[model samples]
Target: MWQKVIIPFSVSFILIGCSEPEPLVEPSTVYQCAALTLTATVTDTGLDIQLPDQSYALVETISASGARYRDDDFAIEFWSKGNEATLIINGEPFPLCIEEGTLPTSFSARGNEPFWLASLTGQTLTMREPGSEQELTVEAPRLVEDEPIMTWSIAAEDGLNLMILDQYCQDSMSGQSYPYTAYLGREGEKEAGCAGDPRQLLEGVTWQLAQTASEQAPTIQFIPESNVAGFAGCNRYRGTYQLTGEGLQFNPLAATKMLCDETAMAVEDEWFRQLTEVQSFRLDAAGELDLVLADGNVIQLQRKN
Candidate 1:
């Protein structure tokens, strides 16, 4: 009897002592996904994030209680009933629209500026610019609004339109306003201020074929104010032009069908395709011709010097 009791009691004591206690920790915190992010994730799982290049992503809540315990995972931004964060996309001046959600969309990656999010609200508000006036004023919405508000301007360049950020314009009388669109040969516009007709600007400017799909060389030339001609790979190419209120019509271009890899013509072909809008052109004080697109991309053109 004594032997059995001693053995069982010893075994029980050893087993109880072998178990370890739970470790201490702190609760978790979540952060919004970055605009330039390759991936979307919430820090703690409460707020959502809209990617700079991609659309918005939603975050799922973590079901946990007490402090010092959390499970981490990668996720996109999403909105829910309790979620309340005010996000002003590019300072449109419109009220923030909060709803169940739009839909999963791809990223335009046009232009995204720096901003911060504090809280969420359903009311929609637009950041509006008081129209232009003749006389200058000290206090006005254009001038009074803080930075991060007046972020971008629109202008045009060679065969391309630019939506420029970091570049600015002021009403002068009041302050600055958001210039969303542009019209050529009109007020508040640049005629490329080069030599002769718009076509003369491309004169002597050697635009090489950076990309091609065929063996035939394209008939590349500047059609003064109307078109850009040449061979796009194998497609015999002829592009018609329009300005101001008109649209650019690519007249069913033709090209040669030959095998080729990445070339200069190919690269330029792609660049031209992406240029849907031209915002502005400026011969900066540095004597550089800067081309800004409607999508807010700036390309500097040097005079082959």
Candidate 2:
């Protein structure tokens, strides 16, 4: 015969705990990756990116920790910290080092990442995936003269590419044309004005002669009223100018009838001759203006800032 035994409260609790165990529950965690919608131009050599309101050559720095884009059933992500960056295509990761103050040409040195067969032709961009037969293409937006808009294009993957375009559209409420990208469908801040106002970029800025043959460097000023004025080392001159697209033309310049040293006068004469041969213009990365002449001569001008 078994004898009935009494257990303490602690023993009874231990027995209950041994009879059944509680199920474990795991916490759900979510990882957030920053997504960026940038206008990408895929070219034969590489890619070009810019803000909707800025020039293709000039792109504003994005503050996001990372940017992601998806196309052709594939996704690409970029993580940027300072000048160093990492790009993720699908699931594979590649390291990239970005150059400051300018646009990048390639994905660091790792642009050949088994994907993105890219090419560009005119305003069309074409791209194709490696090991796949299908391709994707995107075309750039069109522009009209005096429409306050500029455009650039990129082609991805050997005739398969994407075109990115920008337009200056005024907000109905503000009555101001903000930089807008139709490809991304978003408007950015004043940085969109990074392309700068065409008038301000052309007017009232002083350009000092750079690397000229003259003993005294000449200078030129393009005033806002379309008047051009500058000193030709020995004499001050005034004229009218017209800017059509990238073409720059100066009307006949009238100079003060002042005679100076023989050498100085000779230099002035050459300066005036070079000025009359101007055809087009180019702006370098250092903000220097190159007034290209018909004879392939460049009269470089350093902006006074």
TM-scores for every candidate against the unseen true structure: 0.25, 0.38
Worst 10 residues of 2 by lDDT: 102-111
lDDT of 2 by residue, 180-267 (tens): 2222111331111112122333443468887766677788877645677888989999989876534677899999999888877887
The reply for model 1, stretches above 4 Å from the true place, is 1-220, 231-236, 245-254, 262-269, 277-290, 299-305
Best-performing candidate as measured by TM-score: 2
- TM-score (C-alpha) between model 2 and the true structure: 0.38
What lDDT would each prediction earn against the true structure?
Answer: 0.31, 0.48
Off by over 4 Å in 2: 1-198, 213-215
